[model samples]
Target: MRLSGRQIDCIRGGRGVFSGLDFEASSGEVLAVVGPNGSGKTSLLRLIAGLLVPAGGSVALEGGDAELTLPEQAHYLGHRDALKPALSVHENLSFWRDFLGGKTGDVGQCLAAVGLGHATHLPAAFLSAGQRRRLSIARLMVVRRPVWLLDEPTSALDTAGQALFVGVMRDHLAGGGIVIAATHAPLGIETRELRMGSAT
Candidate 1:
């Protein structure tokens, strides 16, 4: 399947962030959105994930599930971890699994995959930034989604944590899943770069 955005436009707070943007991403491919601050990198990903409405243009998926919209088929990992500080790592993940409305996955296995298995009972607020990020990564594994929209995915990760995340992303792509990330750091994988701002 392929995701395409044609002549897209983004306006925020009555000001235009970007306009006439165009791009396409297909299955088993990693699309990296690279741009400086205020260049609308996050805006573009949000548009593709259906979190933001385009002022003009369209985003369509070809050769995919006709019954579900693009956003419904995607897993959006934004800057925030989206976890409840009062809950444990396992609890946070379990909550998302139930809320996202999908077949239940192995939460323990997913936590182990991200190196959070030992911390399953620890409160989310007690974990370090890197550990918290790993918990967020675990959420991606609990529910199967074809499209992954990640913004600064490895922000709080250290060298080892980043390496682990790269493996996770590679496995997803190998499974024919599509990943679209907005990041300033290297993704540790070959990606089709979509540079925004004046160059585009």
Candidate 2:
């Protein structure tokens, strides 16, 4: 599948964030978005994920699942991990699995992949920064989505966790998935850069 955005524009609070942006990514490819703060990297991802509507232009997927909309086929991992603090790691993952209609994969295996196997029963509030990030990474595994939209995905990850997540991303690419990440850190994978704004 091919995902492309043409002449995209974004406005927030009646103020312009970005305009006339264009990008493309095919299956098995990674598009890394980079720029300084206020460059609209996150805004671009949000537009692609349909979390925010574009003021102008369009994002289209070519030869993808026709029955589902683009947002339905994507996994949006924003800056917030989106975990319920009161819930255990397993509960949080399970809830997302059911909610997202995840029909495959073992929750334990997913947690183990992120090095959080032992903390499955622990409340998310008790997890350390790196551990919380690992848990968030686990959510990506429990449910499968062709498109991954990440914002600062490596924020609190340690070196080992970064390496582990890189492997995970590689596996996803190998399986014909597409990843579009907004990050300041290196992704440790081959990718095409989509720099935005003058600050970049």
TM-score of each: 0.96, 0.97
Model 2 per-residue lDDT at 125: 95
Q: Write the per-residue lDDT of candidate 1 for residues 1-200, one digit (tens) a residue.
A: 89889999889888899889899989999999998899998888888888899999999988778999989989999988898999988999998998897656899999999999899998899999889889999999899888999999999999999999999999889988999999999899999999887423
Candidate 2: the clashing residue pairs are none
TM-score of 1: 0.96
> How far is 40's C-alpha from truth in model 2 (Å)?
0.3
Where is the poorest 10-residue window by lDDT in model 2?
97-106
lDDT of each: 0.90, 0.90
lDDT of 2 by residue, 170-189 (tens): 99999999999999998899
Which runs in model 1 stand beyond 4 Å of their true positions? 198-200
